[model samples]
Target: MLLGYRASEQYNSYYKPVYYRLAESGGQERLRELLSQTPSIQIYDTIESQLSELAKINNPQRQLTPEEYKVEVARYLDGKDPDEYGVWVYYPWSQKLVHLLDEEEFVQVRTSRNLYKIKPEELETLKTKKLGIIGLSVGQSIAMTIATERICGELYLADFDTVELCNMNRLSNCNVYNLGASKAVITAQKIAELDPFLKVTCFTDGITADNIDTFLGTGSSQLNILIEECDSIDVKILSRVKARAKGIPVVMDTNDRGMLDVERFDLEPERPLFHGNLNEEGIDLTKLKDLTSQEKLPMLDAMVNLSALSDRMKYSLSEMGKTINTWPQLASSVVLGGAMVTDTCRRILLSETTSSGRYYIDFKELIK
Candidate 1:
């Protein structure tokens, strides 16, 4: 016969069970065994116990609830010294915590917090706004920033490219495991993991001229912001034109030494200066499309001449290929630029004016 009994320790209330087994031979032996088993049952107390019983009682580790975490974040943001409360150890990035320990580095954190405090309305506005981001290289940074801020109810991610090894340097939410996955698909999966309720629409093929109308003009297109980070300058311009035409403000962040060229084409007709110049009266997109590469060069030269753009500029354009490569200089620039873009977008959404224009931040000057 075998029996088990559940038992708990009086000190900690931790539960475990004790087991007993009995064996039988002959009838007389079995009766003797049964009688002896009760008395001879070696109560081998096989119970496990923690070595540091006092520590276990005093400091039991438990995860902070979401609300508790949010409250902590808010308090930290409000300039409360987290280290004094001993809660700063839990959050490594807490500026208040860092400041309390290192007074020399405290000023920078305080300044950053001051800037962040200026956009209180942005936090609320982003929760209800919708944004469409094309190209996942630099766009991933933008998406992550937006998601971190808890803004933007829905996000539409579009990219035709797959996660190549070269993209690892700049693209967030990309890993070796996602190397061959479509950028849009991987980004959507990552965003879903971050916030299950975030409405995400992924287009693996990306937005083309033919599908651009459907993407931005459909009944589902309620986007408040359109971010253009495509590899192709032509596509970037085209996407901006389309978004502007649809009355959605277009924001583009270029990695020109961590500088941002923000154009708010929130015009009634949503016309952008680039489109206005490119789509001039005599321009023929269809004719240019039909021409071969060899034939297109001469036509492009003629068009450049007709458009009155300088020969030097035209030569520079010819020398610069279409694909925007991510150099270390540009990668660093894009990150800084993305942060500025996020701040600017927040200001715009909140209807606050914090000076808007094509702002450039020279790293050399910044370092100096």
Candidate 2:
């Protein structure tokens, strides 16, 4: 999986980063062996730069010269083995070795500006919460945004599909190079590159009745908030049902007209799925799994409020199998939806927002 030289994936090693602590026994030797074996390894060590920034943060009044900054970095290490100063992260897929400050310092320097906006206490508390995101087209953006913000300590990603050329139109984390990789794997790798400390669990097979219980969690392993963005009609209804039963909040983004829907199943256990969009008589949610994509169009329309769709979206929907192969999704809408959903989730997780209803951030309407 490392660029051109493919190693037999007996251990699925490409998706994870291997950490090397030179001070530990055999760590230095192992790292050296890895470097020697990989002919096209890319080395990236910015520990000195990070140390300089750390010094500035610690002593804002002092402006150190070049030589003084060097001294400051050495002083910071303070006799600690320079090789063991920070973590050496080896990303298998890209065959890149990255040097980063350990978790505490890395987070401090990485999220220093967010201190007041997120609040030091809130950021710490947010690390204890667990969130799950289903689907990866728009969910990829949501996951990347959440990871970049360090909004959750643990994240669960479920996507049954692989990256395709068409997905790159909206999936920012994917590219032509990794066209056949699992969406969940691609997202997880991206998150790892951002913050190796954050725990991520991937359901590459996507969620089904079999793994639903485990994904949503049971007892102490439950998710604090659930974000559903899958294209499956059955999953949309089924996940809500499960989340409602567990009193977990569910948030979603339609990537159309900036629609963000929140269902606080935790607040109201009796809340109807999709805000009662599927509650009408003769529409059986249980049978949705048995229907084809074309057959499920009516339910999809009702759930998304066909009448309220933007004129362009409505027309696009009408041309799903005619003029267009599927619903059109631009990169702009997907990115905006990611931000909208992340903000809503942060607010909900921090007890800053509790209302459950559909909200629109339609730029055309707002700007006018």
Candidate 3:
């Protein structure tokens, strides 16, 4: 009976098009209001509407199945010459759609614009570039950001850590079922599900000095950018050195007290500050790696006597009981850092003049 009533209501709704049309016409404004009241609904409707429009345009003849619609969308967006092969549709904001060379361009237009504010030419550039990300915790956020841009042709993910229950707060790919799974694998799976053509290489062992060469030196042409979100200072320094050697820029993100710090190490052989001035005499990287978590805490505490480093340790020890676990710090740092990194990457890829030096964002300032 409920089904019959629903059917009848639908029929009546079709007949009374004016009311439905009026409601639908004002839906965008109502959606803005609903977003404030119920955020999830806004997210759902926004993604659904855009995807639905994408489906309609891709399959105007209404012959393609839902799965086919997704495939067609991916193909259209990722294709080399989207305008030449497919129909070009104009979005509301920009005047960039010149031709429908292929399916990939459609995907590029849909995902990039939805995820970030990127110009048309910049979107095109993203399709041809490659990115390497070390550390999958915050790296997952970076991947999601890059995937949304649809700019990168391939993504190299390196992480040794597996997902834990505590990681759900920050790592997008980590969940109940995925606990104990290697972060790189889970992140690669997520990216594959989003866009099957997104070429991904996962290294479950994490990036190390020995294996770093193989990971980055795939001989598949030049890498456009490298993102370092690894926990080890040694790995971070090594990555910068390798990028500098290869003439590729490196971007790193850090978070402190809800504020983000972005550092861009552009390709320069004579870069002044190599690794943010570490007191090499106090701590040996090899010895530090072998120390237990508890032992490592005091060692780290003693190694870097800087007030900022000590303050961070004090806050962490007070909250987590001095094991020096990296999860909380990583979680807080990675997301905000990923956003800043993504924005910086966009600006760089677009050939826009962006501040390449260190940048800091204090959320408290915004509250003031």
Which candidate number has the best lDDT?
2
TM-score of each: 0.56, 0.92, 0.63
- lDDT (0 to 1) per candidate: 0.53, 0.87, 0.58
Task: For candidate 1, write residues 1-368 as lDDT tens digits.
Answer: 22452211121111111111112125335434444655533221111111122222323375555565555455443554332221111111111111121221222222233335745455445567788888877887887776555456778888888777877777756777667667776666665444434567776688777877666654445677787777654465567667666667777665554445555666445444343434445544334345555654444333223234334333545555554333232456557756876777777777675333455566665787
Predictions: Cα RMSD each? 18.3, 2.8, 15.2
Cα lDDT for residue 157, model 3?
87
Best by TM-score: 2
Look at candidate 2 and tell me the lDDT of residue 164.
Answer: 79
User: Rank by lDDT, descending?
Assistant: 2, 3, 1
Q: Which clashing pairs does model 2 show?
A: none
* lDDT for position 331 in model 2: 95
Tens digits of per-residue lDDT, candidate 3, 229-332, equal: 77775676566666766666677655554333323445345453334444344545445456576655543333233244335545775666447455355565
Better of 1 and 3 by TM-score: 3
TM-score for candidate 3:
0.63
- Choose 1 or 2, whichever is better by TM-score: 2
